[model samples]
Target: MGLTSTASASSEPYGHYYDEYSTVVDVTDVGADATGNEPITPVLEELRDDDTLLVFPEGRYYMDEQFRFTGFENFGVVGENATLVPANYYDFAGPQYRLFRLGVSYSPGDRIRFEGFDVDQTAPDTGIRTIEAYAAERLEVRDVTIHGQHDSGTWGPGMFNVTDPDGTGLVDQFRAPDGGAWINDTPTAGDRWRGPIGIVANQNEGTLEFRHCWLGAFPDNGLYAANGNGKIIVHGGLYRNSNGANVRVGGNGSEIRWPTVEVDSTRPEDRSQRGIRIENGRNITIHGAAVTITEPEPTSHAISVMNTCESARIENTRLELQGEDVNHGIVLSPDCGEATIADTTIAHETAGGYPFWIQDSDRTDRILAEHVTITGAAGDAGGFRDGIRCERNNCRFNYVDIEQPGRSGVNRNAIVNTANELTVYESNLRASQHPYIDIGANALVRDSALESSSGREAVCLYASSTGPAFKKNRLAQGIRDLGATDVTTWANTYE
Candidate 1:
């Protein structure tokens, strides 16, 4: 449908919400009538006061190197099924065509909604980015698909080396004089280097929401909203197979933050590196999501909870570790804030090692896990041990089931408590290959079952100061003191 003929516009939709002097112009009218050289600025310059530049439906609206939509609030651009196409400024001089590239930059709080459009970057300005919403506030980019597919490079080396970034990051910035300038373009440059994600609200304290959209293969991440205290919500979309993480929040060295990433994958990856990674940010929550990542060489963990995160919650999620040589289900390193893992299942190790590995950074940190199941598949042979493993003074496991098959299979323990004051209640640990009772300091094992190989000790209490208490338990062979602190058993009978 054409923008002006809408029921709202026919009866003066602008009159109800806007002033009389408001201008409405369809960007399709700016094209070349004779197919030669036509500048689109004059058509945009005619924008009157309170005017809404209604971009027409289903047509390519080309832009010069740098199209500036600035200093205009209460007047915005709205279009459906419209594509804002960007091109480079080519200067024909001395038989060689020199290319100048430009990017689209906008002001803050510009209530603009770019819906059902594809921003194409198949031109020069290989370093050109699509929409830079610097100082922008409340910009909503929905149902917009953006990709950098064309090759545009001058000489020398380019900024995006898709294969390897050497030391520097994937993206580098350039100063465009008039939108189209020869950027760092080379043979080994990355694809999707031209078009950037539509809306980027960096350093601007505005709320940005990306819903039902496909944003991928860009030079930077699909959506990068950071620097300032901005709320970013990405829901019902597919973010996959990119140079960087699907979504990245919080920049370098900048701590004390609150950012949220909520996703429900349409298609999942078994070997996903890190679904939602938090570096120096507080109050991060991920709920009801399934992440399947390939465990490529040097396999990345499913989730890496880094330093000083105040509150992190992962609920009703499934993490399948499908990697090659390296894999850790969840790596909770030192000095973590407060972490909670509830109602989750982890299975099928494509690579090597355990199901859940928790390494400590500092002491006295807190972790609570409830109703989590850790199991191994056929590919997961012998050394697939330790369901819940943690360092001293770190974590607590409740109502967890860590099990393995026959004695010929590799040993696996239910709860490997390496931390002090750790407690495991109402859980079952039955492994045929390894010992069942793997305890550390001041740990308490209550009302649980530890079943091991025939004739082997079911509970092997490791040497520590506070002898772990095994109460109301049923075991195959019973508890073994590996020089542990003290072994206390109450009304427990073993075979």
Candidate 2:
């Protein structure tokens, strides 16, 4: 396994790089007793100012409380095929003790590194947080597996629950379904108790990265990286079988932070939640990855981007099905947030859902939808759906194909545009019935083939002539101005 930033430091030919750093301490030998049922704090305190802690060359160790550390610089904790178990699940639920607190307030000028370890929670509700890098730099968590269960009956599963505690403080009594015994009755209580991915960074201005790891299975989300005003990146990891969402990225200010989260969804469809969610952040990029929520019969939506994001990109991804009636493959609500979705394929979505649904987000301008394909299975009789539905202005769509089965029912709109200044060009709009394109106001439909049922208009422009222009459309019927009987002919040759 390669380290996040230290891949160049080729000290060890195989295994982890810490093997080259001789100043290593075996937690068990240092009085921690890897197999002992006690906390590892005593052994962790005895280490030198700069030492690497090793555990379980091939075994497991359980931890009950949050791992607390202080006064260590360039500290390293390494393990392979080893497990760090929590003493009790309750310790991380309501009390929320972080598994490890690196760069403590008292010791502000220290560094910590974790590698090749299997970190899990004893109870379902307990979350697995790696470290909160406060004022610390050059920290890395690589080749480590953080595991937890979405014990539906339990309070919280894999990650930390920072929200308000639920009615049942214990995980055993909580009531929901599927995974654990503790499943809350209230709608809001599900994520509140289940906790998200344990790795959280608050108010930090440093570089933090997690590489080649497995992170997921919490009540709320898989990972929560918030209050961040620095550089953050995640690459080459597995996020699956989780309860809530997969990842959350946000922060205050406009200093333009660089945060890139790329996850390889290479597991069974039953291993994850929402793909990637970004709220209140800027300068974000999600590229070279895949997202699928497969379970519950047919899968639901894959990814959702909302709440004022800017300079965002989604490319080279696939979304598979899990359960039935899971609508909207990707929901983009970047109100005033500029984004681009290109070269992506969304298929096998059984439900007559929108592959790309963008609405009422701030900036309508600077949105580019290109070379995307959305198709449904054969014998799947349903129409009046959309390949891409946008309700914002200044939007542009080019070279996209939206195909649907069956005739256009009263419920479908192949391509819905409600923006003030919208443009649809060089696209294939194939709806088996009704209208292929439905325009709201001030839009332009150029060089696009709008094909639908016979006698129905190909482009339904409900806009006034002074609102926008409709030209270069190949359709059965020409553009129909709102409330006007006369149809305006464009340079388009009818098919």
Candidate 3:
């Protein structure tokens, strides 16, 4: 609650910024000492920008060093049950550590504020960083509460680092829960303690808003931004147990709305966690996300719109994978450019792979999936496999709904196209051990409804498949073109 500047006339009638000239200063009236051994950084650098507010009333405020705040315009820092305890990284005072270093380095300031504190680094391993805001043009960190174990080593100290680029901000109701625990045991630091990253927005060119946050156990990323161009908005959150990606947006036009990600495998060295990773963005938008992967390993992917992402959109998402090595739910790699997934609901149980994975390497055009709904639960001799593994090319699946139940191994196809302009409109594929629409060259099955029942044909055209068109399809088994030349089965009705 701070932002009022309009009282010039050398304002200073009585303490606490008399009437908005700002100067509250109450670190025990400049003597500083709240039980945890003195040293309040010279009374907060003599009230840093001099228009200060710095009021830490309540308890424990023992800083061994590093609280530097350079060039402030309308600065404010209010704490009420105050607690900023860090003094054990070899007894503090080390090469540029941080507990609060606001502005300086391409300096440019205006209204910086940090409210209601609680940065308790769990005593000792202080690798620093619990609020580092540079070049602020309006940064307001609200209701903060970060506790212990940021791991300590390669720059790990869980919480906020906002790098401004004509900034516009609001990191509201933040709460970091035991983020990234890697007690530095040097041996070439292989996992690097998962690189403590939980709320990092660099190169922000106006528009950085993260509201209602509660990030816990960030192993690498739990809300990150890179190579900015501006716009990073993660509204509403509860990201937990991330070993890699739990919300990573590479700026250009970012957004991750209504998030509720919870991945479980209990830190098995962070077996490749992924919830929402949109790299190389350009109109990226993930709406109503609810990704839940419980006890699964083998490179988790619950939504990854890869590099060179352009015109992306995942609507009404709800991806759930519980156990049995969950892999992909939605992944479009290899020069991904044009993508669109609507009304999604991908559910897995004993899954061992694809629900939707369009990867082929430099051959992506328009991949549009409409009203998607893929459900699997196989495993125990023939794990739940493919659902939609297109190799990317003019892809389109409207009204899609794929269900894999029980037995189906050795590449159990439910809809696997090798890419060459494919479209399965009004789809509803059901497989149990193979073909349900595994095509190759220029395929199109309009008004579809293919079911494999128990394998062996429901449309399997390989062997250099060509211009295949089966209109009005409703096959229950039968349509094999191994040596295809130009297959066409119109008005199909095979039972």
Candidate 4:
């Protein structure tokens, strides 16, 4: 009892701990029965694994089976007002169903701890899966709370399936809210209900931290980690209404600093749901995120750096679009390699797509957008579209600001270059219709502010648009150059 203070000085008759070796068991003195219908997993498998400390001092505990903890080091499990209720996925007990299966995948343990607790899986059609940890090095799960409704089927149960790779861990203030789906039935082909994940870090190598968490409505992801080589940190979380992505990083050097990913447009089957999905990952970093998509028909996208992500970085992010078929607001696919979007803010009242979509793929190269801000909303006849749709070739837009107020028929353009070393500096390109910088080759628009109140042309230049350059620009209208040939307009100012 040398080490004390495990927190729980108040909060009514529950939550309390104190461990410093001295070893404490207290599973109802030994008989075990907290009014939760007998079988407390054979008195917690008869504790005593080096430096033991298991104290569940206040209430319901009835696990049917699958509560195995292997090869512990400095184990600990303290709960005040504890509650663990399993036994309902075909009455559990087969093929690793799990209510708590801590440590032992490749076998590696060290200071494992699971504090406070409440795993009341609502019951009804229950599937079950509240916790499953393995390869623990310094694992710590604090203040847990996972309440029912995970929809069953699919293989059921999935609230936390950790996998410590090398060491270091902490999942604090965790809360998994009613995440379960696949009601209409479908999963007999191989069984698959571990999808509605609320907190998943499977192939982890080390360093896994998720603090102040509150994840709800999961169908597929809500704070995940895939081929984890290591490093996954999500500082303050509140991931809601997820069907696919509410925070997903393929785990290389993952970091989602300030999270608030929302998507609950009356739950239109989740409308594909995506608020933060960075696949493959290398140096993925999404700082200060506040992605919202009310989902009128949103098919996904509010931040998607796909596939071969290399040096992905989106800073000071904020992508909001209340509804009306919200689509893209930052998507760089086709083998995305180098990317950096700084000081971002892509706002669209009722999105029509493209707030920054670089496609053409050629294994995408340099895409740097600085001090960006792309806003659009103006009646949505066909919905407002295009703010930056490059074809992916050494793209760069400095001090960017593209505001569109409607119109623009045949494919809309407020800045739609077809790649080829495009660069637009000191930008502010407003759109209403015709070409507000739609050039194609080696493009360059310096000191820009190309307006188009109802444009016919403000730099159209198409015929392979070779070496096109419009210097010192401030064009209201002019410069069509359809058959473009070595065009170079210096010190421009067309009214």
Candidate 5:
């Protein structure tokens, strides 16, 4: 009872709205074990009430069953210096999945906050979800750390959602650094490729923000909040080594800002480790991201813009990739809509891949890349790799610099475009291989410097190409026109 007086919402993660509750009950004072000897699930059921705060004192609390509640006015579980020991897979009660189902999707709670619980799932085959909450109005989950490799094939650490469209939620500093393995590696799941995700909010319908959350490599994904029809904001997080995609989000008005995604390792069953995947969303933005993949899988990419995405904006992002595998920087799918990449740089020294791979998309789906820098080939490419491979039509690059050094052979180039209505304006394109700039039909290369390091042709118009225009450009080893018709060149220094 003495420890309950020192509890205050001022030191909480996002606790400006918590009111002063009149009743505060200690779990140990109400027939609960503090020595980690007995399960406290029954006592928690009895202690559940409205407009009250249940504070766990300094001790290890063991719970084999879940404690669920919903549709409450004001209820909070505060555990400042406490550790929750969950039972293993076979010994856990009920569904053997989650430990706390605070508010389900149907009977959502109001103004719920669960804070300061350090979960100890260190036993063999011991892993459970610490919280699965769905608050209708205000939800705040903070300072929850799960110290174990979630190998039990259950749900991951946390799952939160604000049920109402007008509600808001915040999950701050929830660190689950020791990620999980595949479901085939665990004992509970049978023959599954992937396991649980780190923090899931797929059913969210309101505004939810994840701030400074650190997630290690999980087998399934890092932050799987991609399908919810709400505003999901990830502000300042370090999401590393997760398969599929580290931080995958898609919703209306969603944003991933100041995120650091590192893929330095891979599991045996890991297929790909994508940095950020945006799908099934509109008006999405990824800003100020540092995506570094030192160890990449065969299909791994830094950022993937799926075809279901309506529009996206990637600005002020930096990508550094180094590996002996085929990994790309930013991949735009074929059916993707309008996209914008601005103030971004990609340093790809991988085995083979493009820095920017704009697939063969529809002509109406335009793309604009401005102030981007791409330089690589410090390591030899395994195959033909270009700095930018634009196969889609109606793409534009403005004030861009690409220097792919053809580390292995002369088959590589700076820009290889098979698309029509292409424009490269005010850019510096340099390649160590022959034909520094390879062009297709109906393209304009204006106010740009094109050169090759091996003293080869600066531009190569394909034989099948029809129209190409070069104006006011400094060319080094002049153009090699391979039967390209309607070739227009004016004010171009052919040196």
Candidate 6:
């Protein structure tokens, strides 16, 4: 009447906690203690079966060792108002690492479902991995939360991987908000500053989707699912402060959308916590994401498109870079293949950095910024840079706006182009100290408004820079030519 303890409790009505059609094998029915006293590793080994459902009915299930099973056809493990308490590092059994390792990369389950469990790792030196699910196809992990910090420095909370090329997975509503400490501070013997990650899927080879997951700070990276030959889609999550990048992703056809990434805290041994880092991949896209960095270092940018990417696009995104240090907003790496930033706004309110810095790596480059706006108060930016410091070739800016007010700087131009063959069309550029656009060779500016609020030249032609055509632009303080050859201008209104 209270709780059914039948040995053959298959397809029987077992209280309101389960349905009549819920054919399950209760852990207590198979000689497992539900009072959180003894270890459940022995009970799980005796009761684990294929094509079965293992249910943990309402109690604290304690685990002192890892429960590993692999190469199953179909399996499911669900808990009803259950809490899994793992033992401390010293008291745990062999390896003392993870609580559950369902499948390995080589031999994985075909269909795996792990849902509805709360983990508690609050005691000293009592952190362990909650789940490491490696399924070949059709994985569903939902509504699992891990409470307390990870101080034992084993593995992180969760790791999910789809090991086949045709596999698909979905991990939904997985939240671990307490984060973790560094490895040096924990009982784990290491000198590394980072302890573990919140969740990882680095060995994935199939399509994996994470929806509405929340992860807080760890010494290492947070939500790092980047290094794999699979497609990773992060849809609507909140990823906060970490040492490296908060949301570091790399895969072909990967997308990060509607994610709120913020970095407001910095540890003592922390390096840089960039908001979003596209480490390496092809055809990656970031859309409708908001990244805000309040406490950042020199390398902590809102978004950094790294050098090993084939192509990346950022559209309809907003970035806010605060602090009194040198922090950039959106940086396009030098060797990254053809980038596009469209319909985005970057507010770089830092001390000394550019809102947009297309790096000056010595290679042939091409980038396009369309319908983008860059505005902030970076008057004392380092190197006296501009709002857009572009040192690449064959770049184009269409319907763009760059208006960073410079108060005390030597070269705070609106756009500084040091490379060849740049084109600016139908844009508005305004600077406070220097020229609006530093004209290089083979440059073209047409149908634009170039203004200098500090009464400087609208266009500056460097020495030995040849072949520039300026047509139909409203120049504020006119052009300043310094020994330039083959300079051509027509229908430009000089003020």
What's the C-alpha lDDT at position 172 in model 6? Answer: 96
lDDT of 4 by residue, 1-495 (tens): 222334433442322334354465667777778888976877787664567777787888888777677776777777786888776656666653566666766664566677688877787655566666654668788888878765555333333323555678888887876666654432232365435566677577778888878877776677767567777788877887777777887667888888888875445445467788887768889899888876635557788888667878899988886666647778888787888999999886663777778888776468899998887662343453677788877888898887776633333567878777788898888777644555577788899877776656666777877887889988777787778778888988888
| Model 4 superposed RMSD (Cα) | 15.3
Residues forming the 10-long window of minimal summed lDDT in candidate 6: 13-22
TM-score of 4: 0.41
Residue 367 error for model 5, in Å?
Answer: 0.4
Measured over all alpha carbons after superposition, the RMSD of each candidate to the real structure, in angstroms, is 8.7, 8.4, 14.6, 15.3, 2.4, 3.2
Number of the candidate with higher TM-score, 1 or 5: 5
In angstroms, give how far residue 112 of model 5 lies from its true place. 1.2
Candidate 2 residue-wise lDDT, 1-495, digit = tens: 112223433543223555545465455665665664666655565564554444445556656545555565566666656677755444433334455655554454254555556655435454334444332434544455545443323323222111111100010111111222223532224545543333444444544443443444444555555555544455545555444455555533222112222222323323335666665667666665566554522333566776566557777666654334444577877563777888877764444556777876556557888888776632222441666778777878888877654322423445777656677788887655434444555667778787765456666655342355557778766554466233345688666
**Tens digit per residue, CA lDDT, model 1, 125-231:** 43234443322322333344433443343221111111111111111111121211112243333532433332243442333444444443333334444433444
TM-score, each model? 0.73, 0.74, 0.42, 0.41, 0.95, 0.93
Q: Identify the candidate with maximal TM-score.
A: 5
Candidate 3 TM-score over all chains jointly: 0.42
Clashes of each: 34, 48, 1, 7, 0, 1
Candidate 3 lDDT by residue in tens digits, 284-341: 8889899888765667788888867776888998998777664777888878788899
lDDT of 2 at 27: 58
lDDT-wise, the better of 4 and 5 is 5
Model 5 residue 230 CA deviation (Å) reads: 0.2
lDDT (Cα atoms) of all candidates against the true structure:
0.48, 0.52, 0.72, 0.71, 0.87, 0.84
Candidate 1: list runs displaced more than 4 Å: 1-21, 30-42, 45-51, 88-107, 121-128, 134-137, 147-206, 217-222, 250-272, 378-384, 392-394, 404-408, 435-439, 453-456
Indicate whether candidate 3 or candidate 4 has the larger TM-score: 3
lDDT by residue (1-495, candidate 5, tens digit) is 323443565764323433555557778898789888999999989888887778887899999999998888778888858899999888898987788888788888888878888999888888888899999999988889999899999888889999999999999999899998789888966845578899999999999999999999998899999888999999998999999899999989899999999999988889999999998889899999999999999788899999889999999999999888878899999887899999999998888888899998664677999999998884434564778888888899999998878557545688888888889999999888643444567889999999888888889877877688999999898898778899899999988
Candidate 6 lDDT over 307-355, as tens digits, reads 8888889999999888878888889888888889999999877778888
Off by over 4 Å in 5: 1-18, 191-193, 378-384, 434-436
